[model samples]
Target: MADDRHQTPASGPAPNTPDVVELPDVTRRDLVARLMKIGAVSLAMALAGGGAVTTLTTAIAAESTKSERKYRYGMVIDTRRCVGCEACVVACKQENKTPPGVYYTVVLENGFGERPDDRPLFLTKPCFHCEHPPCVPVCPVGATFKRKQDGIVVVDYDRCIGCRYCLVACPYQARYSDFGENYPAIEHDTPWADVPSPEYKQFRQRAEGKSPIGNARKCTFCLHLQDENGRYDQAAGRWPACAKTCTGKAIHFGDLNDPDSEVSRLLRERQAIRLKEELGTEPNVYYLV
Candidate 1:
């Protein structure tokens, strides 16, 4: 029985092994702080990216507004003063080198008489150049578009797909499709002119076969003349060839948006009327009765 107390402790397991050590509350707090910092960084990046996108969107909107609201050129024809002289019509043909039966402009006959009570009146009709142009939408391709600055409707011949949808849509019948007819009779007289111009591009020498024949064309308010240096100078305050060449000075072209312009003022002072007002085309072309 010697030292039996020391040898009797051998048991199945120890009683005080100390439960698994618990993490400190401070460690949990530090972990949460790190997570918050990462979340804040991510949120800041998202906000910055959103701000950049909003800035770009605002800039694009401003540019679009500027382009759409810049300018709108128009005409005011004095029907009372027109003398039915085809000078403007002939000038347009000769200058632009249009073929027979393809007139950019025409003098419309209203009545037949020589005296005031029985005098024949004339109305020269050209492209009305409507503000909300119908021709632009109907075009199969975007060949025709109104200038964002001046509101002048123009045709991009090269881009036109010869769909002819614009021609049918126009109420004024202003559009003309080229037929590729050449002057086989006139010796040395090409159906197309050789003048290489941005505004008055004569599609002559047109690849021996290719011509604007398949494209839609119309009056551009004589933009070709306006492009030439000093053309407006020679015309004496005129902006279009038709208006410049009119001996009676019946046609007037100017910025309708400018109330101070001569055409604008005339339109205001006179009983101005547009062709086919029932259709509501808002034709820029005005007539003074």
Candidate 2:
């Protein structure tokens, strides 16, 4: 059983031998076998090294691509289009059934001075929905978080123990603690009994009216609107009610990732700014100066 790698070549004459380059047939065959074995070993080593390099390169490239992916969900509010219409404020109140004093949306009126020629500008204010939301840390319970999947700050109502710490911690004054109350006259008009929407979409029983009824709530960026089914709705040209009801079309909502999307284009083209930019909360919501 000759080793496969050392198998001898077929027998032939070994009579001729030059004086200067004298070598027996058996010696020549042995030398040839040794060279072939070394070549095979070198080839195997080269292939193994090449394979390792290729695998590592591919892995590193994939990681670099993933890490370079920017994930800052944001919005652009065009102040020029805002016409002091409280439609967004009214729509939000209607959509969320907010108590008389608790408002999820408001308009800040900036007056240049009281005079005939004085100008008053209206700024639509909603949850800034900060990237590093301050509300997340103050909660004794793990109720609030910025979702890594989409960067939308959210409050888990079930986990919220009606503590208003988040409400106070928020710089934008976003959170609102719910009070169990409903207009007696509008009892038949349950806002939750309609098409899909975040304001009234997912409902569970509040514990003896202590549920979300007493828990804090805030803008969710219309979470339901970000779902796959919602995108299907958007493709058909339907948007969230607040944006749909804006007569001036001041509010724009779309994927921040798609560079060509309306929001993305506005961010690039306008002198957009977020509220309290100095704090470095990195609010996703932006306002056009």
Candidate 3:
């Protein structure tokens, strides 16, 4: 039985068997580091509304769409800034030489004066250039079309049959039938009539049985001012006449494809509304209400 003390009994704990290993106490620094990691993850999700991976994916998709499409030029009108000066309307006529009763744009005034505090609001209305323009399909001659290059709706005067289908189809009432009637000066064949209109950049002098006289007319966004590639030089004064002449700077025009443009930025930042949205025309024009 010598050295029996060194050998433990089989039922008792062995010399190598140690007490249960205990975990180290969590330090304050460790707790803080864990919280910071969680917070970073949460912030990324909150910013992206998804996760970091989704954020990167969305940005790439947006870039791809922009590179493929030219632009859907549109307008963002700030009603609060409009002064009902009708400067825009006048400028449109001067630019396009539209005859009487063929208004490309108009100012509609609404009064909310049930009480003394109630005020009147002025809205500048132009062709909305709907994603699905109602005026497009009804054209019997395929004269009216929303340009594939830009979203601006255009009428091929040469093909137009002088029918007023577009005027009835437009939800915004943006189209007008030009009855070949003119102001006294033009009706009388005065020198003013000799000055060729800049519409379509055709510079065609006024004459009976002309294109605009019989065909339906609407705002071109002054497309004539655009270059061959449909790019307008704002600094060179070759932009929409209504926007360039706005007395209150209420009208903002730009390509929707460019996220950096002023109209796009305003739409992102402000509460904007489109007319007759229930119809699902998806009008490009927006009103800052």
Question: For residues 123-198, could you state the per-residue lDDT of candidate 2 as single tens digits?
Answer: 8777876756788767776566665545566766666788799899999887787777655434454544332323
Model 1 lDDT on a 0 to 1 scale: 0.64
- With a 3 Å backbone cut-off (N, CA, C), the pairs that clash in candidate 1 are 113-118, 113-119, 113-120, 178-213
* Residue lDDT tens for model 1, 1-289: 0111111122322211212433334443343343344333333344444434333333333323323444556788887789998898997776666655667888877732344776778878889988657887676555677665566678767667787898899999888887765454333655434543334434344334455657788888876545333223334544577887899989888766666888879976889888787875668888888
* Cα lDDT, all candidates: 0.64, 0.60, 0.75
What is the RMSD of candidate 2?
A: 23.2
Candidate scoring better on lDDT of 2 and 3: 3
The count of backbone overlaps in candidate 1 is: 4
Best by TM-score: 3
After the best TM-score superposition of candidate 1, give how far the Cα of residue 57 lies from its true spot, in angstroms: 24
List runs of model 3 lying over 4 Å from the truth: 1-67, 111-116
lDDT score of residue 283 within candidate 1 = 81
- Candidate 2 whole-model C-alpha lDDT, 0 to 1: 0.60
Error of 1 at 11 (Å): 91
